[model samples]
Target: MTDLWADYVDASPEQAEALPARGPFGDSPALADELLALVLAGGKRATSGPPDPDEPVTVGGHWVVSDGSDRERVILRTTEVRAGRLDSVDDRFAADEGEGDLSRGYWLQEHRTFVRRVLGLSATTDVDDVEMIFERFRVVWPPEHADALD
Candidate 1:
């Protein structure tokens, strides 16, 4: 992680100093690798999670992304952040997540299961009102391809 950050900072001297990394993604090794692949491929430009008020995401903040093994592989600059109930996730945001057919229904179903698992909620627990923080970012390190979608 330190080496990756050093390389990025050295290459982009004008950008702000690095912030601590937020994730390798997902709750397990396999899942983390899967999501990281999507981000690298430019199929994923957004993600969401339970709100972290103490460290709210800010636009222009650079983030280091790692693989399941905790080795940093990419840097992302946040472009947007939104907070709302899980029920408020929209179709566009779902597509930006780049998972499961790029549909809102798939997102909801998958996230509902994910949220329940990570939070230790019972399968029957209602999560519609859970607070969520949605974030959109762009790959800024190693540079993105010209054809990569924004």
Candidate 2:
């Protein structure tokens, strides 16, 4: 899986150019929808679906599709995030331990765009370094929700 992930990430034309990236991800990172609910629900009730008013939704970690509803709930933990990656597909933790899974759809949507942008930037900028180019791509690309060019 690591190899596959590496292959996908390395294939980015941006990764091929080597550009430097600068900036902080910022507060209130993006959410993956249902996963946030499970963490806050707590216990067995911590499955996905419309969240309970008492629970605080967390967008990280492994999740469960509710008992009767076809929704997923995630388990939030402070140690499950890395950059934009989730620690557990079911646990939405903060990214400080190492590389968490960065395959969430929201992240992918923007990342794909960033890759394309980097290619264009590297092809035009004074910087020909692929890695550096990928870095710059992240800034130019829009958020995943901005996936639609509209």
Candidate 3:
């Protein structure tokens, strides 16, 4: 990870002073790899989850996305951030996620399951009441990877 960051800083001199957040998607190795592949293939552009108090995402902030083994794959620049109840997720945002059937119904069902397992919510808990942070981003590094998707 450090080497990847160094290389990025070296290539983009303007970002030499920037400190970006770094992490892989999902809670496990297999899931992280799956999501990373989706991002790389231009199938995913948005994600949502519980807010992180220590590393709140901001528009224009950079993030180094990694794979299952922690190999940095791309740098993503945040374009938008929205906070709302889980039930508030809409069709547009769901399609932007590029997952399942790219429908709001699929998103809701999948997220409800995710929340229950990952957030430790009981089956009876109302996932609609949970707060969620939705973030939209564009890949910024490795021009070829970003360009191919475009």
Candidate 4:
């Protein structure tokens, strides 16, 4: 299978670039594709990381987001980064995630499962006050192409 970014880099060494990326939910490719689609559609603008004091992706960093097959789909530029307890996530950020009715209740309910079921965190661990990294980013690739006119 073709690695999209590698092929691009090979074709255009001067223009092509690479950045860090990972599947949306660790190694789950299917969910990664779905989440990437949400971003592409302007439905998802932010993402949260698991409880970790050390931030992984930093502000002003770029990411090459990929799909289920690990094919590069979009480029994302981090615009903001914040860290806080998961329970402190407000409605605005939850809604911006574009998932499950766009409600805080939904975010909490779904994230609980995501943190446990998907991420494989300790099921016995208390979720409240867990350190969470929130990142806001902007899509930088697949520019809205439009026909040029004279």
Candidate 5:
């Protein structure tokens, strides 16, 4: 099948050269699109993912952020990647997510729901202080060019 994000991304050789291999962002296409919009709007600078203690988190890696359908959206260059307890996700980081009122309370509620629903866990799962992989990234593709994706 044709790549779903082909229309939404610039796939020129130069862009590809800098992109490396990029992984999608969210559990669903809608959620990926939602978060990608925030990133493009300059409202989101940070994100969190399920923790993998055995795997190394690579900083300075280029990732293709995608929507739910697995379509590439924007290219992200990881600036920092660290593991932290979910409970330590403070107000500042939550606010940087730029989602839903930009409050820690909202972040917790929404993220908890996302973890349980998307990650396929019990509704009664305790995530209060669970381990998580937190990452800070910068847009590397479109931001470097003046032209729009369309």
Candidate 6:
């Protein structure tokens, strides 16, 4: 399992090379700031409901993809950045046999609300930068996802 936090990330080469250009959304710097705000506000967790008042707010990072089964493979991991560390509870959200996927619902709900309210997750940004942001800004529970670390 990966450590609770990491100084370096083991990212897919494809993800390591990703970089997205600005789009119709607006300025890249502003978008980055907003993302930073969200990251700092609550990290990058996908929640089933509103977060706890006592829960510490942090930044989270991950790579999401629809697997061949069409299930969302939400890779939740920790990050180390100048700002601090971060990770999402969604990474900690667990599932039972034949149960619905929380990560799928979590991201879908988060994106819907984000698009309708908070804007978008990114504006044509590269994957590796996202990775770096994650590596630099993520916070997580190390014991839950014990298999993802180096």
- State which candidate has the highest TM-score: 3
lDDT for 45 (candidate 5): 81
Tens-digit lDDT string for candidate 5 (1-150)? 444234224554444444345455567667777887788788888888677545445786666666667766676666788787777788988998789999999999988877777667899998776677878777756544222432
- Model 6, CA-based lDDT: 0.30
Off by over 4 Å in 2: 1-103, 121-150
Q: Candidate 3, 29: how far from true, in Å?
A: 1.1
Every model's TM-score: 0.90, 0.17, 0.91, 0.76, 0.75, 0.21
Candidate 4 residue runs with Cα over 4 Å from true position: 1-19, 22-27, 51-55, 118-125, 145-150
Q: Which residue pairs does candidate 5 place in steric collision? A: 22-64, 28-68, 29-67, 29-68
Residue 86 deviation, candidate 3, in Å? 0.7
The candidate scoring highest on lDDT is 3
Number of the candidate with higher TM-score, 1 or 5:
1
Write model 6 residue lDDT over 72-124, tens digit each, in one string. 22233324322211223223331210112535455434333433333344544
List runs of model 1 lying over 4 Å from the truth. Answer: 144-150
Instruction: Assess the local accuracy of residue 94 in candidate 2 as a C-alpha lDDT between 0 and 100.
Output: 17
| Candidate 4: worst-modelled 10 consecutive residues by lDDT | 141-150
| Selected candidate, larger lDDT, 2 vs 6 | 6
Per-residue lDDT for 80 in model 4?
86
Which residues of candidate 3, in runs, are more than 4 Å off?
147-150
Give the clashing pairs for model 3. Answer: none
lDDT for model 4, please: 0.70
Tens digits of lDDT, candidate 1, 42-125: 799999988766667888787777789987788887889988999899999999999989999999999998889989999999
